[model samples]
Target: MSAKIEVIKNKILSENWFVLRNFTYDLTTKDGTTLRHRREVYDRGNGATILLYNREKNSIILTRQFRIATWVNGNENGMLIEACAGLLDNDSPEECIRKEAIEETGYAVGKVEKLYEMYMSPGGVTELIHFFAAEYDEGLRANAGGGVEDEDIDVIEIPFPQAWAMIKTGQIRDGKTVMLMQHALIEGWLSLT
Candidate 1:
């Protein structure tokens, strides 16, 4: 059974970067109890992410960048390794991921296979990320991708075994990247032999 909810009030808290709104709503429980709740939600629009892998070489491409949020939280250096991802903006999920792959990894990827969509943080953030994967090779190299505007990204291509081990060693800590890597492993797309 799903609970019913109705918005009582919504006010803009901030829009410096994206949008932050304070919402007051009444949530009716299954037992007919209605409770008024107030919450602040951040809406930065939706996004998409992709993992680029080469089956023959058993290697995958990832990016390293400094994330301010992680730094403020606990990460000392805030340097994080993540799959190529970006906001959807006005493009479709597939199109957005394809563009992001090129902008972040320099790979004009071939046929892409969408894996799934997920809400990374549903409690306060309203971002639904579309996940995808594609095979890549040297023939698809478009440019030396390091992000477009203010983004400073470093592209890294590592062997599947080493990359996978980074998860245990706490090197690869991004959620979306970890999920995509695990999916590739389970699907036998990361087999060396």
Candidate 2:
């Protein structure tokens, strides 16, 4: 038998960039009881991220930008080093990651390998993040990518060893970025030498 839930109320709290809603529901339990619960959910839609690596140079492409949420949460300067990522926005996960890579890192990537999909913050946010990795070369750079007008992004290229070290030193704190880096290491796509 499947569990059943009925929504008692749904109120929109905000609808500026994305959406924030408060939901009240009654969930049927296995013990023949119904429990009522309330939760606030932030809906920003799903997103995709890519870690660009260059086997020839033994390096990876990353981006640094200011995140307002982190800043308000006591992250000193709020600058975050992360993999290139963006919302799906009517596009497939693979398509979104390709566009994000070019727009954020100036790399026109190809042949991306999909890693996994995860719910970033399931408790309060409704965002499913798709992770990917691709090989890149200098010849594939089409333009000087720094994101759109409102987005101030700085592209950085670092050796694989240095990037891995950053995670241990608390320099790279973004969860998605860390996961992709570790995936690369475990897959033997990176070398210590």
Candidate 3:
């Protein structure tokens, strides 16, 4: 049984550079078919990646910014501490993160160590996040990291231990960012031991 997507309504709230909106939807289950129904309206989303680069001194690179959408989820106002990442227009996850690293943090990430591929919010929206981590040693620094025009970003550097602690204590609120950091810690990928 093929579960069909029955979209009750998809409205356009605001569409200029990107689109924003309030979408309401309901699903009519297929007879005898186990299909995912659109029971509740969905949140807006786009694809993104998280980059974890460990410099030679056991420090990791992170970014700080003001996230309006994050405040609604539970992140305290202003200051989304996240790894280097950005939207993937159509590029593969690996490619997207590599590019984002250079664009956002001016770091040239080497061969990325795949961490996780998952949806940021499976219950409401389709925001797939691809995560990777690499050593941020020599031959990785590029131009300073920052959004081209509109985004205000401040790079933050912290030792690996502190980063892991924050993830465990919920200080790191970005879903994908947290997942990537935790995976790296447990798997012994970013450890000196």
Candidate 4:
């Protein structure tokens, strides 16, 4: 299956936090039909997310933060519970996740196992997030992490069962958080009991 695609025009819409552009492309289908399509793409760059779990305590570290986009999209509180994540800016996915873990959760995680990569919103957003998981303990706490600068994050540790229940209760609506938790459960990283 091969489709010929040609970029017709590109216009920058915004470049504040990231690049947002409008692209017009001419595509020729396999049936010899040519179509012109216009799409707006938001290039916020790729990111990395980590789920920190403590096997002894049967708990996982998560973060809650305010999201303006979610709030505008009918989320009453606009606050979302999510895994520790950050954009991989000029660093490898592993390095970014490790730094983000300590910066957001205060856990100086050593070894992070890369799980997979996913496009959270492939239609309009050009972001591929690298997923990771690591074991953490209280002894590895380096500092009281709540993110840096203007990012206000609340670190929360919830029992495995409770965390899983949040998904069904609508409390844990973040996709990445849900994916990581389900991954942990399916992989037997979390104690079933």
Candidate 5:
């Protein structure tokens, strides 16, 4: 089937960590029938969520920390297991990956391989987080990266094989983290063997 172009109307409902707004699309049939749709979205900045992986030593650097909001409804183990990620923060996905890598894990990435853009939760949020993986040595330790005083994070390094097992057994709960590691396995991106 084919689609046609149409004009739209958008109204802001509220703005916060993410933006929630109402939009109306006006579609006119070739025969002159009019149709409209009102939909709402949560504005999670078109930011990037990156995964900084070290292929050389076959390890993936991740951040583990307690999430307060998540605890209210999330698992009793409110500790979030996630990749090295953050908002785009005005930088390109490439730049965001590099910066977040150092800031969250203290690793200086040599290069980044683009994975894909992801909307963590499109049904409610607008986070178009991009995924990436870089090669580094887990044995090499730089500054211990974490967020500012307001932000809390603890960096953890996991062997590629262990990460793969987690995915295979459904132990990796984080969506983005699971996706990246699974891709690495399927694509042979982490086959040190």
Candidate 6:
């Protein structure tokens, strides 16, 4: 079944960081019923994320940062452990993630395997995140990465078992990180032995 949508109006509510617009539209469903609704949409463009792992070391790279949104929403300290991620801006998904890995984790990754693309929040945010995985080693460390500019990020390298257990302990609640870790587990990309 397909739903036909017609925009009645699009009013820009805010244009500070990204964009927030109010959309009034008429949706005609397959049942021939038409309904008018208003919704707010946040457009921050697309993004890319990568899970960097070291098979030989049996470890993975993750970043910890303060997310204001989570803080206001009941997160105690707002510090979140997440996969290396960044907005695409003017770069392709692969290019963005590769660059992000270096900038955020100090690893200039090679041979990235793109897992898939997903919409983290399709209801309000118009951002599609391209997911990827790559192998890393000490030889690839270009710098003591803590992010550039005003971004303060902590690059943490944890053993595969410990990192996987973080999920159960709620220490790693970031969706992208969880997904990548699960993917690695399901595909036997890392193991305890």
Give every collision pair in model 3: none
Name every residue pair that clashes in candidate 1: none
Tell me how far candidate 6 lies from the true structure as C-alpha RMSD in angstroms.
Answer: 1.0
Q: What is candidate 2's CA lDDT for residue 185?
A: 83
Please give, for residues 88-110, the per-residue lDDT of candidate 4 as tens digits: 99999999999999899999997
The stretch of ten residues in a row with the least summed lDDT in candidate 4 is 184-193
Q: Provide TM-scores for the models.
A: 0.96, 0.95, 0.77, 0.97, 0.79, 0.97
Q: Runs in model 2 with CA error above 4 Å? A: none
lDDT of 5 at 11: 82
Superposition TM-score, candidate 5 onto the true structure: 0.79
Best by TM-score: 6
Predictions in order: lDDT: 0.94, 0.93, 0.70, 0.95, 0.75, 0.95
Clashing pairs in model 6, backbone N/Cα/C closer than 3 A: none
| Predicted candidate 1 versus true structure: per-residue lDDT over 28-73, tens digit per residue | 9888999999999999999999999999999999999999999998
Residue 14 in candidate 2, Cα distance off native in Å: 0.8
Q: After superposition, how far is residue 38 of candidate 3 from its true place, in Å?
A: 6.9
Off by over 4 Å in 6: none
lDDT of 3 by residue, 105-138 (tens): 7787777777667776676565667667777864
lDDT, model 5, position 7: 48
lDDT of 2 by residue, 56-157 (tens): 788899999999999999889999999999999999999998888888899998799998999989999999999999999988898888998799999999
Query: 163, model 2: CA deviation in Å?
Result: 0.9
lDDT (Cα, 0-100) at 134 in candidate 1: 97
Candidate 3, 16: how far from true, in Å? 4.8
Q: Give the runs in model 1 whose Cα sits over 4 Å from its true position.
A: none
Off by over 4 Å in 5: 1-9, 24-37, 138-140, 168-171
TM-score of 1: 0.96
Candidate 3, after superposition: displacement of residue 167 in Å?
2.9
Segments in model 3 whose C-alpha atoms lie over 4 Å from true places: 1-45, 72-76, 168-170
